[model samples]
Target: MYTETPAVVMRQIKTVNGRRMIVLFSRKYGKISAGTSISESGKNKSALALRPYTYGRYELSKVKDNFYINGAEVLRSYYRIGEDVDKYLQASYVLEFTDKLLPEGEPAEALFDLLTEFLSMMEERKQAYGTLVLGYLCQAIAWSGSAPDLGVCSGCKDAEVKYFSVKDGGLLCEDCAGKAVQDRRLIFPVTVDIIDVFNYLLESPLKSLHALALREDLEKKVRNILRSYIAYHLGIEELKSESLIV
Candidate 1:
């Protein structure tokens, strides 16, 4: 069967006989791996669409259980993302992170649209790349249904929360924090600023990220907290592109 869909080229691996396997996060089919002979150097629409940081319409042929890319046309390409090393690494980290979050053949249209918006915004962003990354991470985690409880204490449901407990999966009250520490669970003391940053990122749209900027200290602190949170809940320890970012 043959079908066409809008997709982002996530990653590509070289296969035998010069053919390549392309991983795509498609709007219609979610994540799918398709084999194709199209070369990035070829002067054709399909070839251009095969490159990274591209959003394109792909024509795929499914044979029994496998998919092959027949043709494609670039809808939009954030090629400029590669111009700066910082921007490129950040963009790569998100793409890789998204690939890990998605299950094969499962359609996640919300995530698909979020990625599209992320790439569009990142392409034009000039500073505070970490802020954008943090926003994307918060939104992505929420969409994945594992968002940390920020409204109130995850334990005891107390309105007054002072710390974030990774094991409890959210904010913790002072008492809960003491108990968590006694239990040897990992927890971080959070300020109102930290909690507010997370709340804003989770509730606001990606486009609004431009309005928010965090001091380097605050951004790193939140990033570390989310990293540990994601590792515990999502089972993702570290992404290869993560080290490339900073």
Candidate 2:
């Protein structure tokens, strides 16, 4: 059986047998793995499509429950992301995070689009990479159905929010904030601007995020906020590629 799907190469791991196993996040089949003997010598048609950061249509053949990449055509490589160290590292983190969070064989169409948009934009982006990354992180979390509520206080619901509680999964009202202290929940005061920016990132499209502006210091803060939230919720201690941002 053969199938074709739109996919992005999330990763490529080399097997002991010298073949490459590509982990693809596909629009149709979600996350999947297929082995290919495609060499990177520019002689194989599937080689470029199999490289990480390449988005393309992948043709796969199924044999005894395993899939092999029969052929592929690269749509957008986003290869420029490798031109700069900062872009390369952050972009790598984006793919790493996506690979880590999404479950195999579960299709998330919105997430697939979001990732493609993110990679496309990242390729040409010089500034606002941090903001773009934060936006992607927020959208990815939301798409995964683990988004923290940003509207009402997650604790008291109706009260005005004063702080964000990672343990509670969202903002908390003053009353709830005091209670959280007693219960030893980790909480941090949130500025209105931070809330507004985060809300915008969560609701806006990836293209709009390219023009989004924030003071340099605030950008770092927001990055930490989303990173901490993801780490707490997803159990990811730290992204390996995060060091390049600083």
Candidate 3:
């Protein structure tokens, strides 16, 4: 069977036989691995569409249980993201992060749109790349249905919360935090600023992130907390592109 759909190139790997296996997040099929002999270096539209960070329409032939790329055309190529090392690394990290969140054969249309919007915004961003990354992370977690509780304390449902508990899966009130687990690593003390930022990121659209500037210190703190939270709840311990970001 032959099918065509809008897809984002998540990553590519080379097989021992020299064929490139492309991991694509498609609108019709969530995540899929398709083998292709098409050379990315070729001076053709299909070749250009095969590289990472390119959003394109792909034509694939499914034989029994495997998929092979027959052709493709770029819809939008975030080629400029590669111009700066910082942007490149951050963009790469987002792709890796998104890849980890996606499951095979399930359609995630909302996330597909979010990923494309993130790439579009990241391509034109000049500074505070981490802020954008943080926003994307928060929104992605929400899309995955594992978003941390922010409205009230996850433990006791108290209105006054001071910490974010990864194990408890959300905000923690002062009283609850006092009686929670002894593992200090599972609890992160949060200020009003941090809570406000999390709420904003989760509630606002990705396009508005360009105007928001989060303090450098705050960004790092939130990133660390989110890293730990995702690791515990999602079972994603590491991302190769994460180290490449900074």
Candidate 4:
């Protein structure tokens, strides 16, 4: 049987001999490994559509349990994102997160749309790379069902939120903060603005984030807080593309 769906190329396309393969994150199928043949006559229509960051409708042929790229039509080529080294690296981190966190065969249309929106914005090169990525991470976390509650404290339901407990997966009140540390849970102090920003990112659509401006100081803080939260929950020690940002 054949299926078609909206998808984004998730990694550098791989080639072996005349065979080309790609990893794609699709709205219908989540993550999938697929391939196609590049004709020796060089008349393959799917070539450009298979390139990294290409968003399009992909047609795949399923044979028993495996799928191959039968053809595709490019909808939006995020070509500009690769023009700047910083944008490329930052965008790569978002791709890596999707590739690593999302499971195969599980559909996540919301996250897929979020990724496409992020790439579209990144291609324009208007926002700072750090700020854009931080917002994406927050959205990604929420979509993955591991969103940290930034509202009133999750522990006491009273007093202002002071720290984020990754283990508990939410904000901790000042009183609960001490016990969280004693319990050896990963706790990071958070400011009101930081919490508010994360809360916004979690609930708002991608375009809504454009109005919020972030300074370099606050950008770094948000990065650290979200990174720590992701690492502790997802068990990722470090993001490879992160080192490439600077």
Model 1, residue 206: distance off in Å is: 0.7
Model 1 ranges off by over 4 Å: 181-185
Report residue 69 deviation for candidate 1 (angstroms). 0.5
Whole-model lDDT for model 1 versus the true structure? 0.91
Q: Candidate 4 deviates by what RMSD?
A: 2.4
Model 2 TM-score is 0.92
On residues 1-246, what C-alpha lDDT tens digit does candidate 3 reach at each position? 999999999999998666799999999999999999997679899999999889999999999989999999999999899998999999999998888888887999999999999999999998999999999999999998888878889877889989999998889999899898658899999999999999899889998898877998999889999899989988886799887764
**Better TM-score candidate (1, 2):** 1
Ranked candidates, highest lDDT first: 3, 1, 2, 4
User: Model 2, 4-93: lDDT tens per residue?
Assistant: 999999988889666889999999988999988877666465777888899999999989868899899999888799898888888899
User: How high is the lDDT of residue 44 in model 1?
Assistant: 89
Give candidate 2 misplaced runs (Cα > 4 Å): 181-185
Cα lDDT tens digits, model 4, 48-114, are: 7877889988999889878798888889988988888888888998898778888888888888888
Would you list the C-alpha lDDT of every candidate in the order shown? 0.91, 0.84, 0.91, 0.80
TM-score head-to-head 2 vs 3, winner: 3
Instruction: Please give the lDDT score at residue 207 for candidate 1.
Output: 92
**Residue-level lDDT tens digits of model 1 in 89-126:** 99999998998989999999999999999999999899
Counting clashing residue pairs in each candidate, in order, gives 0, 0, 0, 0
Clashing pairs in 4: none
Least well predicted 10-residue stretch by lDDT in candidate 2: 179-188
Error of 1 at 201 (Å): 0.4
